[model samples]
Target chain A: MTKTRLTRRALLAGTAAAATAATLKAPAIAQNAPIKIGVITDRVANSAMWATLMGEGVELATKQVNDAGGVLGRRIELAWEDDQDRPDVSATRARKLIGDGVVMILSLSSSTAAQQAQTATLEGKVPHMSPSHSADTLTTRLNNPYFFQMGPLASFQIRTLMAYAGTRFRRVALLTDNSALGTVNATSFRQGLQQGNIQIVADETFERGVTDVTPALQRVRAANPEGIFHAGILGAEMALFFRTYHQMGLRQPVLGSFNLSIPTYLDLVPGLLEGVQFIDVYDDVKPEVVDFANRYKAVHNKDPFSLPAYGYDGIMLTVDALRRAGAPDREKLRDAMHATRNYTAVIGARGTTIGFAPDRRIGFPENGCVVRTIANNKHGHAVWRGLAAS
Target chain B: MTDLLELAVSILEAGGIYALMALAYLVVLRPTGIINFAVGEWATLASFFSVATLGWWNLPYIPGAVLALAGVAAIGALTEQATVRPMIERGAPILTPILILLGMVVVYREAAALGFGTQNLRVPPPLGFGRIDLGPIAIPMQSAVVIAVSGIMLAGTWAFFERTIWGKAFQAVAIDRVAAGLMGINLRLVAAFSFAGGAAIAGTAGVLQAPLTSAHYLMGLPLAIKGFSALVIGGVGRVEGCILGGLVLAACERLVMRYAPIPSGFAIGVPLLLMILFLLVRPTGLIGARGRT
Candidate 1:
């Protein structure tokens, strides 16, 4: 009887060992199947160094996921297309990526183009994430289940800026361009100013390509506002504005939008750009910012712009959802992405929840805006943090 | 009043640049019936060459300017031979040749952008730091140089067109190309000369304007449009009309800014308004031929 009982115990132990082996080997077998993802961006190989950095960010994120055992036990493969920074081109690229079997699309750095991609993604039932476009319409008017924004939209930045300006100045002047993006930001700023009970002394606009703003500055100077909020892209006009404003001796504090942070603006205006303030979502020098910048610089021989961080975060988010879903099914991935909550990203707010409600199409943590001043031609310490009251 | 004076000075400066561009248009139009849409691209290419010569190679400014002008003149002559000759030989429609010029413009702009990245480039002013004080108003030495260059070029062009035998030959071709061809004029040589002179003037404008506004791919488009407007206002195929029209349009734009509460883009509309008034009063343009229209 004792011999029979010992034999039975040995059989039971063998069965348990087999079960453990199957459990471990099953995941390894499943992981052998590669998971393919398509990324569409404006980073044409022939574009500026910034576009190359964006491509590197996507590649790095994909490699990291593959290195750490990819989503749903499958290695992630990234397929990319260049949108060339055009809306129609991006839209077409999105459609082609979706047709080519991509689960999601990543966009280049403009709101107009993102909107086009979002429309294409929604129709194709694929998720679209924009890394650089800051237009509020992407989250508001065009919000959909397949669309997500990883960066603060323009309305958020403008509202935050207006609230901050209200604390210091009573009267303000605004100079904007005639572009749609400029109009939206200016309108949001005007609303924010009204909410803050700040007086708008002068409101003016110029054409996008105007080489000089002397006449516009003269009008604003006549209003004698204490500060000027310039809402325009970094182009010939900004250089003209600085030269004209300096020549005219308009000493009022000048603040610009994100366009001011562009490296081109720094190169063009140089010392004249000092004291200008602008909003930025991420700064590379910040310790909290991710390791992607270092990796990007190592690979591309240049510092990554704010776009790459968001691109890295976007791909990581998609991978995390796929991992959590534990399947290559599109429906499961979509559900898993929507269910994302308190997800941490390298560029996003730390210790913050990232999820989407059924009514809300975009992930939230959208409330961080850092006001940076150009000190000695470098972005100085943050003047304010967190979301300012609208 | 002081503001008005400042506006006037700005207008004059802008007008001077437009005048140089208009002279380029007049140079080609007077010799050949074809209006080269590639004028802006030629100027942009010349400017990039100037930037390369002066900024990259560390060449002296005067030699760099001359080299840029000479290089662009060669390019202009080559364009006439390679592109214009083919169209003319094929007996293509007038618009076909014009469209070809437009395509050349795109190619040249893209080529420049590819070669020099899309970033704005700064070119050091030829004139040293100095400003002319007109009482309370101060104008930079660069502006004075631009005005002086425009005057010199305009005078030189007038002498070349009106005083020299070659100038009469050019005028004779403009009056009757077939008749001048029958009279043993080398039509191809005249076309080559026109391209060279037009390109040199454009190169000069590019170098002078680079200091005030940085050089870039898209810089020439707006300037070209303004030049066309000046040409239309002055009357097409008229040199004196182009100069007068450019100055008048610039003055009107500045005056509108000084007095009217107009949007900055709408300031360009002032010239259109003047063009309309000129069309009504003098249908041939401000200095165009009587009863030609």
Candidate 2:
């Protein structure tokens, strides 16, 4: 009977009123929808050799957060993509993830891939974090406010390592594989040595996957440096370095970058790494790390060493920020991430905390870097802590 | 002079590895005329299997290595049957199969990575990591064993080609696939067997080279490149050429790295330079392909 009196204008007004009502109710339905987080991991690229472990770390953290009841009373659902370690693909994947209503993205691919993904993340106004990349240029290459890096920078590791070993060897040799990251590490290590006023006796690089470096090692032996500072990450090449080192009967102490901190070497070089020392974040015996290691052991039946702890800390901190933001809104959540301080993570020294200050995008403290010795072919005791003064 | 002597002995071990990798390519290329770039992945897969059997499952070295080789051979044969055979049957150009084989390289590589995670799996050298001294010259124990095993493999492959019926069939197919088929040679069988043998050779090289390079998913590409370079320098026609090419390539690389005034990084290009020189001087390689009856 009421509709019998309806005109075209009245009908249009009624439909508009109903549409507005549905729009108002949309937020209530979205409130219970799971918070979407994206992770770009590489499983097919060369970086996958280490990225797999980092991705596993990311997986475990996401699992723990979900098991503990996700943020803001909404379940946290993770969207995963493989970047194939290509920077272009990485940017494309980042855009795809951001387009899918993701609040934030974690790049667990190569540093360059992560760096490239920043373009998309910045454009989308989504907070992005490279939780385990150590490329110094990752932060400085772009002035994007949305990007934060938590990995120990090469400069920090180099300086800390120099503080521990530079005084003992005034003349050092720089060695690395021809990998992009390997070259980057070696360059910084050279700088770190120069800053310490140490003479660089020889510089060498070997191709990855080649079985023989004895030819190259012969030259290093001829140089007769007091120490060999290596920055290689390829397990095979790294092991070859050690094998060639021993084969040539060279007795120089081999100091390494954080690459040695990875547990793969223990399985690879084995008996070869007796007196080798390398730089790392800190001791794994810290209470937080022990807990993380225990959790890892419960599932994997083997205690994790260095990489997974970083992932756990990254996710835990991100979750805390999301909670502090009180909603999954991107701007508010990024602000909360920016305001973070005094946060605890399983990475770095026991007392060292990860946070963003007003002027710094690097979350890992400079002094948090440590130098550890390989004992029994394991990531051994931390012999020194904090960054070395220039 | 002492350093030079030490360096010379090291090349024997390095060259043997490149030789086997070259043989892997040759084994497939001879019968089907398709350059199987996937040989490196086959090698890597075998290395992973050997690691699993010997390291993880605690199988004895002989059985583990054998199982790995046999399994990869089967996979290689299956690959030919699945991919190569169908293309040939459909009258596809040789380039089609070569392109397809390139695609298989990625497939096999990703399969390897998925099947075996990227952890560094060490295949402990059968001979311990000690040094063996040849009078004034010194060699790693693993290197000597690897060189000896490589020699035996080369001899065995030589005997097969020169003395066995199947090897003759392989050669005949390489000479003329259609004519060989007309002569009652099973083209499919030849193709499959050649692929299997090629893959096994690759597996052998991988296991032997593990001491130096270690085993990982990413280990294949470099092996493929080195082998390809050796192939280019050695020529594909003669089995002996593979060994010759590998030795020359290794010698060039080592000599450059050790004696060249250039930085160690530049030494990497020595193999390519040598290959190019060979191409210019002897386009057919150091050992020209002999006419097979």
What are the chain B TM-scores of all models?
0.93, 0.96
The window of 10 residues in a row where model 2 chain A has the poorest summed lDDT is: A22-31
Indicate the DockQ of the complex predicted as candidate 2: 0.66
Tens digits of per-residue lDDT for model 1 on A1-390? 999999999999999999898887776736365776877654322223345445667887887787787766677878777776677887898889888777767775456767877788888888777655566678777656777776666666766676566578889998777655677677777776777788888887776445456677778888899899887763666677776776676799998776666666666656777888887666444554647667777777876656567667778888888777777766777787877877766653333445677666566455666677888877775676546532
Interface RMSD per candidate (angstroms): 3.9, 1.3
lDDT of 1 at B101: 80
lDDT (tens digit, per residue) of candidate 2 on A3-105 = 6667766988999999998888664425588889898988887687667787667778888877776778777788999999999999999999999999889
**What TM-score against the true fold does each predicted structure earn?**
0.86, 0.92
Candidate 2: where is the Cα deviation over 4 Å? A1-31, A388-390
Model 1: pairs clashing at backbone N, Cα or C within 3 Å: A31-A73, A134-A154, A342-A353, A342-A354
Over B145-169, each residue of candidate 1 has an lDDT whose tens digit, in order, gives 8888888888888788779989878
